[model samples]
Target: MDQLHHQSERYGTDYSLAICDVDNFKKYNDIYGHPAGDSALQAVADSLASHGRESDGIYRFGGEEFIFLLPGQTPSGAETRLVRALEAVRNLGIAHSGNPSGTLTLSAGLSAYLPGHRVSSERLLKEADMALYSAKAAGRNRLEVAPEVRHIVRS
Candidate 1:
């Protein structure tokens, strides 16, 4: 967040941050046991790591949630990368009978930090979280971006 703020203030660069959660992760733990659930998480993390660029930062936000920072990327670029990441996880062929897809899946929420705004890291995270909730509400295995969260001055 400090880096993102510095990049925005000093370099006038815009970037996107995304929050991703594995769908039906609790079910995986319940049905397959904790060890299998751990393996599944590792696989998902690998998928996310493989799909992201070296410039991107991937973080585990506890449990089945993750945070991704895409430096100097626009919303569209971030969305594209997320889409690929989602598909890569799906293609991993990890079984999840608890889900409708019958395979592992992820849902993400993305929020962009535009230059010349007074946005805070907390607000950005909240926006992405809200978008994530929307994605879950709409059904998992998709990405959603919070438009209103971008380019707003801090109050």
Candidate 2:
């Protein structure tokens, strides 16, 4: 978080936060057992790390949840990167019979720092988190950008 603040102030570079959750992870665990679940999580983490850019920061937020920070990126750029990352995971072909897709999937929420908005890192994460919940509620295996922060970006 402090890195986010420092980077923004020092470089005036836009940053985007992505909150990701393993879809139907609990069901996967219940059916596949904890060891299998751990393997699945590790696979997903590895896939994400491989797909992410060198400039991006990946973190295990907790449990099946992961967070990433995209520095010096615009909203559209962050969205594009995430879309590709999701596809990369899908291509891994990890079986998840518990999910509708029958393959392991991820749902993510993204929020970009607005240059003039003075949004705090905590608030940025909250917005991303809300968007994440919206994605899960809407249905997993997708990504959502925080609606509240949509207008913060200028064309």
Candidate 1 segments exceeding 4 Å error: 116-118, 149-155
lDDT tens digits by residue: candidate 1, 25-121: 9998999999999999999999899988898999999999999999888877898999999999999999999998999999999988875434777
Question: What is the lDDT for 59 in model 1?
Answer: 90
lDDT of each: 0.88, 0.87
lDDT of 2: 0.87
lDDT for residue 13 in candidate 1, whole number 0-100: 81
Candidate 1 whole-model C-alpha lDDT, 0 to 1:
0.88
Candidate 2: stretches off by over 4 Å = none
Extract clashing residue pairs from model 2: none
RMSD (CA, Å), candidate 1 to true, equals 3.2
TM-score of each: 0.92, 0.94
